[model samples]
Target: MTLQKKVIWITGASSGIGEALAYEFNKKGAHLILSARRIEELERVKENCSDSEESVKILPLDLAETHGMNDKVLEALAYFGHVDMLINNGGISQRSYAVDTQMSTVRRVMEVNFFGTVALTKALLPTFIEQKSGHVVVISSVMGKFGTKFRSTYAASKHALHGYFDSLRQEVYDHNIDVTLVCPGYIKTDVTINALTGSGEKYNKMSKGHKNAMPPDEFAKKLIPKLAARKEEIYLGGAELMGVYLKRFVPKLFNKILKRVSVT
Candidate 1:
């Protein structure tokens, strides 16, 4: 269960939670495959690791390009010849209303957030089955459990992840492959800044909620323990955690509260 000596491959490693996880796992003496679309940023993150040159390998990847994911998985395995864990963290966000959002934008969001992650996981399944031991960690969101204003498509994409991975968990349990779904609430990251607008343009602005959210490093520190414990699902955040429980136990009340919640 310990991350020590484990070969962990992390997507979206260039910044935010993914970058923090790389540092945390590096501290635990885990060999890391850091991947993101920006190779330069990935290298920068790798350089900051404890033993950058020895323990980290930067693999530039664009999760939206699902067609190339199998090849990318091959390249990832080439580094250590095997991988103990795969973290699906690369995804986009939305900052527009459902009615105004373009269909192309919805497809793009789903492509990167849902399809891309699914494709990569499928590519790596054979290896996990062969090894008879591997872990899959998905970085989903609180929105996956419930919809909120300005996040219809983004929430849908996350909801799809929950459905897909939940099923995959059951199917892979006998294979000794564990699946963990991490639903992180508001965290201080560039997700809002990079979120797509109705017209498919970057929002390019950070929200007050995001500005005051938990730091990515702090969130990562708390998450590693849960991951090591092989928890099926864990929610990391402040009061937002309550929404998941409320939705399950008090659907009517939760729906009323959701309407008044300022998710932006």
Candidate 2:
């Protein structure tokens, strides 16, 4: 279906890629459900949409509040009566070495990035089944495809999404439910500063490479069309995207390069 008439619900919509997606989809005439923990920020995104008067609903939510996901999702269903698509984009990043990271931090990352995403997807599955049509767009990362230093838990969580969503795609293919996993590299966003370190503190610092990364708006512009067409797996970013293959055919080379990569 054309995005012009689609109803999309986006998480992590307060800023970055999610906010950009909200704007891009609005330009295409889609009804949007913009969600994030920051209500004011979500409202700002809605205001920035192509048509502010149009049907753009703001639902502030925290993915980390895993227990309340079902209720929030049900409330979302009530917003439009049916959700045409769910963009499972709310997630955290890792900024510490695996050994140095705390178990609590790892679990928290998994909860927000993997389990919480799955929970929301499961809650919405019955709705898709009843209609026999829907799309699930997951914003994964190149790190999801291949592991790197100081980001073990983040990589694992993203990798888990790939496995789960890929399987779900096949299971529901016959029912017209499509799943698209977006693997983005270093598109500029606050993901780095907000990432959790080994001690579970916010990194609060930008990586040197991130300052020169792709703009979120441009990334979203490229992504919206792909989602509309329902591509199963799409990769974004520059050399980062190439890392996927570097890990496959040249493991040693990949390890050598990653060893110099720093999250600090």
Candidate 3:
């Protein structure tokens, strides 16, 4: 149940929450596989790990590319024979209204955030079931639970994840596989700056809320124990967590409040 000695694979490990989690998990003595599009950044993260030479590994992957992911799963298994956990953290965000967004742009975001994540998980499912032990950790956003302005595609992708994984969780429960659906609020990441616009270009600007949002490192610190406990669904953030409740209990009021809140 502890992270120590467990083989944990984290996608999007080059920066932000993924990078911070790499450091935190290394400190906890987990054998790590860090994957991302950038090899150099993965190398940098590995270099920073505790006893990294003996425990950490780097596997470059692009979530948007699914043809090679089954092979990537094999390659990941080759590292430690089996993976105890797969952190489905790799994804893209959008920052445009539906009316202004391109269909191609929306598909691209969905391809990365939903299809890519599902491809990897479905690829890894047999291994987990065979071993009778594994964890699927998804780093969804608060937008998954509730929609916001300028996040049409982003919210859709996240909502899709909740539906898919919630079903997957039930199906896998008997196989001793667990799923953790994490809805993270505004963590101080480059997500906003890296978010896609209507034309599929980067937004390149930080949101006002993200200016004082939770730090990724601090978030990583809080998340490890919850994962160890096998919590089914978790919402991690500050005041923004309230939106999840508001939307659920007082839909009319939440929609009115959502309009006034500046998401960008």
TM-score for each candidate, following the candidate numbering: 0.98, 0.96, 0.99
For model 3, the run of ten residues with the poorest summed lDDT: 255-264
Pairs of colliding residues, candidate 2: none
Per-prediction CA RMSD (Å):
0.9, 1.4, 0.7
Report lDDT (Cα) of residue 164, candidate 2. 96
- Ranking of all candidate structures by their TM-score, best first: 3, 1, 2
**Model 1 global lDDT (CA atoms, 0 to 1):** 0.93
lDDT score of residue 232 within candidate 2: 91
On a 0 to 100 scale, what is the lDDT of residue 31 in model 3? 96
Q: Which should have the higher TM-score, number 2 or number 3? A: 3
* Model 3, span 1-264: residue lDDT tens: 768889999999999999999999999999999999999999999998889888998999999998788999999999989999999999989899899999999999999999999999999999999999999999998899989899989999999999999999999989999999999998999998999999999999999988899999999999988999999998889999998999999999999987887777
TM-score for candidate 2: 0.96
Local distance difference test, candidate 2: 0.88
Q: Clashing residue pairs, candidate 1? A: none
**Residues 135-161, candidate 2, lDDT per residue (tens digit)?**
999999998889877889999999999
Which sections of candidate 1 miss by over 4 Å?
A: none
lDDT of each: 0.93, 0.88, 0.93
